[model samples]
Target chain A: MKKLFAMLTVIALMLGLLAGCASDPKPTKPAGTQGTQAPTGGSGGTAGSEGPSEDKAPIRVGVLAPLTGTMAEFGKTYEVAMSMAAEKVNAEGGINGHELVLEFEDSKGDQNQSAELASKFADDDGIVAILGDFSSGCAMAAAPICDEEEIVLFSPTASNAAFAASSKWAFQIAGLASYEGSYAATYEVGKYAGAHDVAVFYMNTDFGASIVENFRPAAEEAGMNIVFCEGYSDTETDFSALITKAQAANPDHVLIVDQTSISNVINQIRGIGWDVPITMLGPSTSQQVIDLCGENCEDILTTVSVYYSEEDPEAYAFAQEFADRAGFGATVMAGFAYDGVIILSEAIAACGDNITRAAIRDNLAKTDGTYLTGPIKFSEDGDIIRSYLICQIVDGKYVIRCGYDYANE
Target chain B: MSKIKAFVGKHRSLMLTAALVFAIVFPLFGFKKSMVRIFCRILMYFTLAGSLNITNGYSGQTSLGHAGFYCIGAYVMAILTTRFQISFWPVLLLSGIGAAVAGLIISVPTLRLKGIYLSIITLGASEVIRIIALNWEGVTGGSFGIKDIPRPTFFGFTFDSPLKFYYLFLGVAVIFLLISYRLIHSRVGRSWMSIRENELAAKSLGVRTAPAKMMNFAYGAFWAGIIGGIYAVYVQYIDSAVFSLDEGFNIMSMIIIGGQGTLIGPIVGSIVVNGLTELLRPIGVWRFVMYAALIIVMMWFRPQGLMGESNSILAGAKIKMRKAGKTGGKKEAIS
Candidate 1:
């Protein structure tokens, strides 16, 4: 038995050794030389082969997605969305006539792995730009490495302030959490006419503090009464006491100002048989929130910076196509990821033949106008200005209650 | 060939010296920078797993919370050096001591709670530590974390590049290895192992179980914290995010899968597990699934792991054959 165990150990160690040396060492190969388009029949297989793909090497974009762990589901959507973006560019004759290919690297939502992959992408000469990292933590982890190596690290969903503060090369398309909180407040006032009193049960943390601080002024300005306001610590998992306190004042609606704790508060409120309307201030914007809350999620109002509807033909088409490819509904994170690729490719194409990291950065810094998200532009700190939409959970699905009234649109 | 095998086995120091020379000259051969980074990562994990092996693998204590100590060490250095503009040289040992103090705080209370209960206490303590870091926005930077952690310096020269980091990690890892080697063969290590074998029996034999357990806990945590300090400087950023349950599990997996209680096993295991995980990253989300499958298969077939369980087929056979060879004086057949 010991001998067999020793043999297994040897086998496992060999596999590990193999994995260590498994990084791709291939030089940047010109597009249309192998696979996709132009067959080995001497470049006369397809008309599209006549493009610069035959002569120029394809631009490689490193995608740092949480492909395996808690964020694996998000990673799936991101993969489909990014590949969809890549395919769209390839169909449109590729970036600058040189094909664009995405090299996916899984961070597994770990800081260590994210940092390692960041260095790998930075070191790889083929990888001209980087996009992804599902969460803000993962993005910030890799930001310093990319910044040091002069590589552009663009994240569509890393909304943390730390990301921007980490490196000059780091760019996040997701609006800051503080901005999102304030914007949500403005959207709520616009939708509800500010006549009803508001009750807020917020988590006692920087994230929770920011939402209420921003929401208080907006709610007050809109002529809403501050009926009952409370803050709870993260360690206070039992929401019964907080729910009882919230039910006493009985404001027109209650805003659970939290991310992870929102769904808990929602479900607990349902257990008490109080059917007052609820709008989660921050967090629990994920699909899993509905899964957790079930029928209770209905009629719940929430504000989101990322608003995609079937009403918009372009969004509808992309959503439909993405669903067909991935066999799941396109998530908000996935939409941002799709837009992230387009933004990078757009900047690379704009660079012409002088497509360098600094050029990509400069081009991105000057970007403005509508793309996937309307009026997309980067501030000096590399954060995007978002026009938040007022949405309500209707029949287990999101329904827009008002237009994109943010930026007073 | 037979004579050569005997001679080589007798001159083990010569073999080790040659291997050490090979390792020292490896990065100088113009290896890829990315590969060098992976090597440094392996070395870092090597120290982490080796330290974990002290409390978990040797002492028979189940701790799922080394990450807390690791966090304490990193944050202590992050706060002291980055905040106070302190030098990195003394802080390295200070971080270890800081982690040791934290371990003492945990182990003293947890000494009464044996096995799984003790593990749970440690796990809860880790989460509590994380929550404290998350909420205390003033000192620890809260959830945003402390950035710009200065790297270790040597004689006015700062180690910045991957090559420099490789040597730094390697040297530190080697020092820890020597420490573990000496400690494991010492009287205290023997007492700890006896307690592991049977606490009631060791206690009956006049062994101070509490002191032994506490010493083991502190020693393990001390090294874990030192690695954490080095890690903070390596990444140049310290956050509450890094100290997750998954990281603790990852450290445990390194020792368990490689060969717990064996000095060489944890090193091999850390390299394999971390290397395989990193390599599998490009394969999409199935990498973790694959890794899990690998561990499940390993556990099923070899519960003692790669080098752990003694009395297994090869270990027992080698002992039997060696004893026979000694008595028979070259007359006994050896395979």
Candidate 2:
């Protein structure tokens, strides 16, 4: 009995000790918990006079990007831009005294991860808008969630035209592939005189197909004949077969919209030695493309939102600020991301304390901005009515050909 | 009452209290949305791992098609809730039952095989399920996945809130733990141990090995289905992405690292693996390398697991035993 008592006592003590030791060893809370520090308590310094509480809280916007992934270069740059916009907004006495807060969540380049991150953002009870998901797939997955919950989404670069028609909630800020295709067609017909045969080699996905579909119609309209339209899947690394087809077509120039398999495609194109002219589209036209293609990248024509030539004083100023913070050249993605946040800032300003999803949506619909991207507007379909800048590789860089606005054209 | 008697009598209540405290207080330690999301995930994987422990650990069957059952449950619940607009509770229950039925069917054929052969067949079964989920684009959303499967709801309250969802999960987990405990203590559990010890001997003792094994598989798969259903609702989405070969590997890793036959082992293993993944994100992609290394080390040093075959209660007693042993010796000399 004594032994049993002793045994029980000892066990009890040990159990208690273990429980104490095991009780939730929380990691030290990082001072800045990324997205939690929203401007608290609506603007009122006048001694406790009960005014509408709606006049106080900042508009909480979520910036969902691959803070970490294959697209982290663009994602991290967007973060830097968004951060600058927030800093600028807050510094300028805030929007009607309602400061803008951008909470950054790393979507980790997975649709499931993006969905979960969006859900988390929605749960914060403060978020009026969300900007993200550089990839169309991630954006596509997340759009419904935001839609169902009624959160305004201003995607920086999920430019799949299919998404434009998918949801009212999906408002893409960059030019869609259809727009890119039309631009490519206009450029090819105007420059190459519509007599030379054009070959289209695009990635085998909805993104690639949308652009290709647009290309055929516009090319035909411009009287430019397609020599051969070949599709390549993401798995096609060598691209020997596709390039061989392009060369066999005997085309003066080829418009290639595939970058799912990068650098290798450029090398394959160079290997074909069909050096009439080559044009590319989608988010793959940048310094990285230059780095990937090297000497092979010259004379390659691509359409972008804007070039960072430090030309437009507003763009140059923003680019300098971005470079100072992000430690990289301000690419189109960074510019769009900057505009995405600044647009939110402007919208929030327009809405004042009524920064609900409806209000944000209304404000976005009403937006007419001379942003860094040039004359940002939104179509009824929620596609950004932004200009497409034609870019050609010159002296190992993306030189601006000319800017053409969709709204104007 | 004597202290020993009192402690023994109060054991269940004490455990209940401890669990309640742990569940309630856990979220308060900084409800980082990521952490909350991870907590929901931990509850999910824990449920799956615990269910897995019933067949693979207790019954000593190396069934690799647990993910198939999991996927079936997920897809069923997702399709029912999202498409048919079924209520969350019924969908969850029906999905679990559906998965259990599927498990029984799969078990009938594969139970005849033993060891690696069974594992291989079960793996094939899981892969087949994955392929179906991928190709059945009209239903399963192909690689694109189904989105916004409604969050769990009960009575007038909706579990749309993470905090509410967390509590709902805790309730379900507690129920599962109770069910698992009751099942483990039953005569069927003893029969399972007999079969695990020596199937031939168990057969000699009129154990009806086929039915018994089928029962284990069914029960194991039922819980897996429940986890899947809850997962569909909790994540509010279901697709081939949620149910993949990698997920199968993750469940397998949980069972291996947590200690195959032990009850508490699966929970510990889930936390260790999942927690490490979240905590070691700073190490970037190499975190997977670190996790693999940790698992390898665990396998090398402690093949029987940290808790071995001992129940958590028994492990608690053993600690007491060692402490008493040390103190008693010292006291005797002093006396």
Candidate 3:
């Protein structure tokens, strides 16, 4: 009977495999040189070309993200946004008709894979620009490659200040780690309990470490003492021990920095019945986090890249479209990634067909228009000049309460 | 009929010759540039799997730290090429040596443990290396990584293009595979099998178990390092996080799912698993779940894996004939 059941299972699996193979729409192959020539900005050597008369070729832009594995959902949303922009621009006519084709590789959320893809893009793809790498670490690893290759790379969502500060090619769309830290630090620590003391629990990784480095300085300057500062690994599921430590400290407010599976930590903290105001950084307070925390997520404070609830029609529409595509379930990083592609495409269109790595770099440098998030401009190092929004969860949604500009300009 | 069979057996080299000819000609005539990259990935993984095969497949030891060695090799090559401005040929050799030494160190503590314990130790070791890579800002460049590791230049010849790199990787992979194949067929391989099958008996046979085990670890580490160094030169960048525990898991999985302990296993595994991964990516997140399920299922049924220790057709034939005789049924082989 067991053998029979196993045979049946095998048959079922085989059928499923066959169905999957049959469903994939074969990737469209690039036609030969002659086919590509139609409406193409012709190479300068050719007459009556659509593109500018530059000796160089059309710039290739490479996009790397976690196309598969844990971060696949976020990656797909970004790909969709990028595809839409690429399609809309190419339809209206690409940069001086030279055309911009965005190539993608799955980093699988592994730093090694990201580095490998970065190297491959630099070596094989002849890419002139790069836009992606969702995590700060991944982007940090790839930035030097871009600098070496002289490729213009703009990261959409990596928030680590140390990462951005390390390389010249790394321009980030997300606010700096220091920006998030200051935003949290400047908040009235004792507003809820009428006390000015705060406690901190953070992941032991660089993301967590950077927040502490920045937040402590700002908090001290604001005349508030950090009553307790503790760290934990992202892999630990139970926060009971850490929560007890924080509760013992008996501070008026608490700060946490965790990027993976934060729902458990939230629940554990709540289970301990500690009701002090909480502020967390990086990949916290998403819909998924709320789903995992349920009522525990209510009134929780967090920071993210966009404020979709704002009145800007374009931003609202973009958010609505993304929410609709994600079945009304989109993460903040997805929004940032979507806008990043749009910004990149817009810059490419601005550059026209004479697009080189240098041109793309220049286009990004001079960006003045507002994207879905807000007015976007790049500093010399490629970081977006925008403020982060402090949001609170009311009725299980991140409500943008205020904006904090971390650039301090 | 017996004489014909004997003649065929006597000249089995024909099959190998045909396979070699096909491998050489196939990429040149029909495959495009993109296809060539995919094929190159297949070869790279194959070389990686070959290294894993020696440690895990042939020796029956599970290592979750192979990618750590790979990273060590890559960083060494990158530092030598870019910071020291050394040539690729010398740098490549140094990378292998460096990785071999690291493997020796990792294996010493790990050789006493087995199964999950060994896996955890290797995983921890790899993670420790990665953290050091991230935090050691002076030499490792922290997260920014080392960049512009020079491409190969040999005897007035510069290999600058993808096609050139592909050939270079292929040549090096083939050499490593040949070395691996010879090692597996040698007395050392028999010692590994003896230890794997019966450790107590092998010890009684004067196998010098610790040295044998360490040698297996060192050799695996050596080749992984060489492959990694080549990768740095190929990609021209080095990041510490790239050598994390996740990479180690992936290479181990490739070896496991492919036929561990066999030449064709890694090659077949890389294509089947990596290709399916890319193909299923449109489904997005569920693809990983599917892959994990596949590994689980394969383990449940064919614990020996797609290709077992004995790589030859003769070994397979021997098994099939025995099973057929016992069951009194038709024998079938699937590729």
Candidate 4:
């Protein structure tokens, strides 16, 4: 009886394992099959069936997104926006008559997992290009593997200066933090806010450090004084100590550089009833900041490369579709992710019928077209120099204070 | 099952040879490159868990700050190789020595502490090391971490691919096992085990428990440091985030599940834990839940661990009953 019970337990565990594997959506299978299936059986079926691209094999692109960890929100944005882009491409009669399929594997925001998944993607012969791995650290971890494997790793949000230059195969759509930092210091703080003495509180990561390092020299050149500069760890929640220190400096303005924790810093600063003018470099046009900060976020200055306003109908349409799918209003990250897919597809489409990884990378380097974000042109280092839009939170909404050409002004 | 165990026990050397041969030729099976990477991870963790077992199992030190030694080794390799362009082979040894020295330093202050108190100190030490790695931006590169670490090469052959790394890790794991086997049979090994069995009795038996414990910690830390150096080159990146307190727990979990106090236990633990990680990848965050459940089940059914010594004091069963029986016998004799 004891042996039988043990055997039963083993069987149950095996069944659970099998169930787990079965539940996971396999990468090889076309994700749009269900949507395409109904159309194929209908009036649209005739055109799709008759098209020469129908019989050709689909071009599969692997995506390394942190689907289940701390960065799941950003990863989900990639999944939704990219899938939306793929669906639109398929609707407009696939890439050069070949179906564009994306196989997303979760990296869980861990660099080790990112590297391993990048390797797995590189191993697969069918996958022509790869996308994502979210944060700069994870993207950098996967950079060496992608470089060694001779495959393109296109990230939507990695903004570290060293990332794109780490490997020729690594390409990031997000503008470097250095550029954004300088722009924030010169244009936003130095010119717009006119705050001479500023205190900076940044996250102690690659993204945060790069901004502050660049912001300092620019801030000084713009005749602005950095009264206090400090960095807090990512997991930091209680900002009372840092706030207290910054308050001691008594600067006219405070600049917070972070993504997810921007709202927390604002809340803590406002929670202590310190009403100093606050400007943020990261978390560009993020709705969460306004939503979380409520009335405290009034007149909070930030910057963005692209703002999905109703002024641009095309971008507005994309944002609406993303909102419908993602259940959250579209942010600049979602736009970048959307542009990442469109731009990669354009590169793959430029390859014509002979689509190899090398061909895709070469064509991608030559990308000079305007994307959902802005006019994107990769420099020799495989990253773009993007112009910024100075935005301010007025009555809990991101109102554009300056256009993309504000730097020129 | 009993018959198979008996046959394996009778022909231990033969089984061992067969297993070793299989491991050596396993990568040649034309598996996917990612599968080879997983095998490399298992081999790496095997050495790491084995080293932790030396302190926690043999000497009963329960050092929870193993990641501190690991972080030291990784940073040593990263700084030397990236900054100075030092050769990988010498830096590898240097990394181990660095960690072993750190372990000795940590063990000195906590020589009198035991059980929970010692565990807490180790945990705190691990965090202190990580925080330093995070803040000391000049040497450690702070949160940016040391990236683009050049791969190790042997006589113009680069260990770049996962397949090449598999062999490097395999060679290290085998050497670790062989050395540990010999050391565990030596007088020093016996003294450490005696300390684990009963520290006071070992002291009365003229065994210097303090030095024995210190040596055990250094030996364990040395191997962890070696593995950390290899890992730095393997990932080609070293960061403070990688050596978290959770990582220390991860190594400890492998030991607990695989069975501590035995040479084969760590090897088994590495395989099972890594294998499960791959198998449960599709389950997303639930995989952690599954890991916790497995550990709990292990504790309930086999507290000493799967291959742990059942008769040893670490088992906490027969030894307690024997102590009670001895006390009762003394009372009867007095009556």
- Give the candidate number with the greatest DockQ: 1
Order the candidates by TM-score, highest first. 4, 1, 3, 2
Q: What is the lDDT, from 0 to 100, of the residue B235 in candidate 4?
A: 94
Clashing pairs in 3: A41-A51, A112-B242, A171-A382, B259-B265
Arranged by DockQ with the best first, the candidates are 1, 4, 3, 2
Candidate 4 interface RMS: 5.8
Give lDDT for model 2. 0.70
Ranking by lDDT: 4, 1, 2, 3
**Candidate maximizing lDDT:** 4
By lDDT, is 2 or 3 better? 2
**Candidate 3 structure quality by residue, lDDT tens digits, A159-268:** 76655565666678776666567656765232222336788888765566667777888788877888899776546778898889888888878787777757777788
- Tens digits of per-residue lDDT, candidate 1, A272-321, equal 99988788743456566788889988888877666567678887788787
**lDDT digits (tens) for residues B1-335 of candidate 2:** 34544575469578668867987887876664545766776777888988887888888888877888899898899899889999988988988998899889889998788889988888898888877876565788654466667776667877775567677777777888888777777878867767777799999999888888999999999989988888777766456645656678888788776667777767766766666655554444566678788678655545544434422222235544554665452211000
Interface RMSD of each: 5.1, 9.7, 9.5, 5.8
Q: Could you give the DockQ of candidate 3?
A: 0.15
Q: List the candidate 4 regions with Cα displacement exceeding 4 Å.
A: A1-27, A32-53, B316-335
lDDT of 1 at B77: 88
**Chain B only, TM-score of each candidate:** 0.90, 0.87, 0.87, 0.94
Residue B274 displacement in candidate 4 (angstroms): 1.1
Our tally of clashes for model 1 stands at 4
What tens-digit string does per-residue lDDT give for candidate 4 at B1-335?
Answer: 55765798789899999999998986796777776887788899999999999999888888899999999999999999999999999999999999999999999999999999999999999999999999999999987899989899999999978999999999999999999888888889989988888899999999998988889999999999999999999999778988988789989988887778888778767766877876776555678798889888878766666666655667677644664674442221000
What CAPRI grade goes to candidate 1?
acceptable
**lDDT of each residue in B258-327, candidate 3, tens digit only:** 6666776787667666666545644545677888997897666544455543222323455446546755
